[model samples]
Target: MELTTPTGASILVNLADDFIHGFAKMKVKRIGYGAGQSDMDFPNVLKLYLGEASGRRFNHDEITLLETNIDTATGETMGYLFEQLFEEGALDVVLVPCIMKKNRPGHILKVMCNQADVEQLTALIMEETGTLGVRVMPHAHRLTLSRRIVEKKVVVGDREFKVRFKVAFDSAGVIAFERAEFEDLRRISKKTGLSLRKVREELKS
Candidate 1:
């Protein structure tokens, strides 16, 4: 853009990079932008008009992503892998099922962690499980979190199982999650005389 004064002299500057610099040199009363020609090389570039109003400051930015997939695996092993991730450095770990390549059944393992540790965690998973090379990528983690576990005793014949009900809570403190894994609750119930409902109810009493 070229700015001309009544003196018949003008200044020419590239509006993109020189906008802030030029504005800082002269007194800026306002700043704005108009539709700029799209560049094939840079999808995000845009031109700016600066007359400027505010004082100066700069800022930094960042992004985080967690990704993993498991197809040739089992529920028990997957549970263990999740636990291992938490132990290693993961903030959160979860499993999602999806139909993968060639229409094979699979689980998408999403793990939240710093970018630096993703590789180690992926390597651990590959070493522990017979899975092929892990597929990792950047992803977002929008989590409202809490922790709770309810122990229930389920009876199957003479055996007792100590099953656990895990529920995650949201900011409102309501249970946002509930997972009842026959996770041994049946074993404890059968060994003891207490019923499943009794054990669950005992949590309150």
Candidate 2:
């Protein structure tokens, strides 16, 4: 796809929502919005649909750094660090063996998690290990397709809930889909004498 700017320059892009083998092609249908954080420099909204393009899309970006070297920590101690991090719901944890200053063999522990967990986890690391400090950086969060729906019911006797696409992606990979709220779902189920799952499924359909 190509876009003409006010200056008369053209910008081009190509991407796909998914691949359908042996098919001619799929074109973009629409874009959907999700949400945004108040303090974000970039829009917090999620885009639901992808536009039509001639081919598949690829992307990469530059980034800032956050690193530190620790020489005195032990293997058993490192195990504790990883366990604590995992218990706290860290995104990732790894340790690379390396030779540090004075040619001492050691491990370079790397921990990666959401920006929100950095401060508290860093404090835990400092308190639990010999590392004196941590390096911090402002990072970027990627937007992806996500959605959920719940059944919301009228007080009289209906089950339904609004399903808006969310900015945060769920493991099932839905951008926006339907749902049924419990309160309404329960009442609807009671009124119709149907199981909760059956009521939810019917309402979704």
TM-scores of the models, in the order given: 0.40, 0.41
lDDT of 2 by residue, 82-150 (tens): 899878766677888888989888877677677667777888788777789787655644433444443
Clashes of each: 22, 15
* lDDT scores in order: 0.63, 0.60
Q: How does candidate 2 score on lDDT? A: 0.60
lDDT of 1 by residue, 1-205 (tens): 3233344232344323433433354355555554435445444333444553343222222324555567778888888888898999987787889889988888888776777787788787887667676666655534445658877674444454556787767545666667665545454455566796765564444
CA lDDT, candidate 2, residue 108: 70
RMSD of candidates 1 onward, in order = 13.7, 16.3
Worst 10 residues of 2 by lDDT: 56-65
TM-score attained by model 2: 0.41
